[model samples]
Target: MWRPSVAGPRGYRVVENADAFDIARIRPDETAVVVGAFGPFLKALRGIGARHFVLEKDPATLRPDEMGHFRPAESYPRIVPQADVLLITGTTLVNDSLPGLIACARPEARVVLVGPTVPMLPDAFLDRRGMILGTVRVADAEALHEVLAQGGSGYHFFGKYAPRIVLAQD
Candidate 1:
């Protein structure tokens, strides 16, 4: 369960995938730095005709065509600080790299922590200057459990059992 971190009007708003992108307000000319090889995010960015840079530790995660946008993780220090918008994968938290990544972003830049691994908690990220969280919500716990038991992944449970949602800080 989640609760507001502030009193009176809500500091965050719930939204769908597209709306979350809109909240970032990324322009075609502006560059967005993505900290992972998240395919869905790449697709959405392409759909909006936005230019972006992707950083990945593994080259295999990107396709031949996507290699043009790929940057090695070590280049983050030079690349991340220039981003107008930054989208970081939640896996960075588990790897203990999230703090360094966040520190690289400009204070005025829009930062979003994205992926199913992202927690619902807003206060924690808000304190780090994260402007939004893109995560999944399990609507049917039983169905999700069944899918996991069958070795099914996001492709099987998404939309039906678990749907994408965004928590945007105000």
Candidate 2:
């Protein structure tokens, strides 16, 4: 179960994955920055030729060939200011880094919070141009627990134990 730090009208709604989660929705002219090491995010950005930067705290998680693409978290003050779109992981919320991360975003940047841990509340998030939430709702709690216990990823549990959904502020 999750709780919100600040609450107000819930402005987000879950929808099917058809057009909602399109990473290409990002304009080709826009430069993107992903805050985590998410595989699908790279595939989507690459498909559209969006020259993007990634900031990952753990350099060990990246492949040897991919090391050049990831910047250390310490690079935020430099790299973040250049981004047109920012993709952040919801884990930032739990770790109490969300506020600082959001503060770094430029006024014109579109900030997106993604992952299962993304809060359902939309108050603080809505102040930005409406965050595109790439989240999931568990369809079977027990099955999801089992998958995690066995070291499964969202690629495994999606549609079986959890269904990936997109929520946007309206």
Candidate 3:
């Protein structure tokens, strides 16, 4: 149940991760649209040769150092349709704008929902072709908070693993 602070003057706060989601497989050379990307994930994406269109309403949330790697899109509406894959973070606050993103994706696009706040109910994203990749479990949320506080982005997970999609309920 991770909550991303609202993108406004007051800024957002850190919440829990009872429902957080994680990344699965990211194929090489995929054109990925990342919504809510922050630190290490952005670097990993770049390392994989992923061309990204980042979406963020808050200018303050953008890190000056990382800006070199990503191109900020005009808006999610304009970016989603052009991508081959959509990597989304499940923020704490409910994002009503998500459906529009789903509607805009190409039919063949692989939509992956990441972060802790993602809903467990499959119906929330199932019909939209969304899939659960994996989740990052942090031993110290405070350490993460400190990193984010200093505008230090990116995370290094020990024994990080990719998701295995099980087709049948066996």
TM for candidate 1 is 0.84
As for lDDT, the candidate ahead, 1 or 3, is 1
Which candidate tops lDDT?
A: 1
TM-score of each: 0.84, 0.84, 0.60
lDDT of each residue in 107-155, candidate 1, tens digit only: 9888988777888866677664547787788899998999999999778
**Candidate 2 wrongly placed segments (more than 4 Å):** 1-13, 18-24
lDDT of each: 0.79, 0.73, 0.54
| lDDT for 19 (candidate 1) | 34
lDDT of 3 by residue, 1-170 (tens): 23342231122122223222133356667787777755555767767777776776665666786665454544777788877877766662276666676778898887766554553334444454434433444566676667667775333322222111211010
What is the lDDT for 29 in model 3? Answer: 70
Worst 10 residues of 3 by lDDT: 161-170
Ranking by TM-score: 1, 2, 3
What are the per-model numbers of colliding residue pairs? 0, 0, 14
Q: How far is candidate 2 from the true structure (C-alpha RMSD, Å)?
A: 5.3
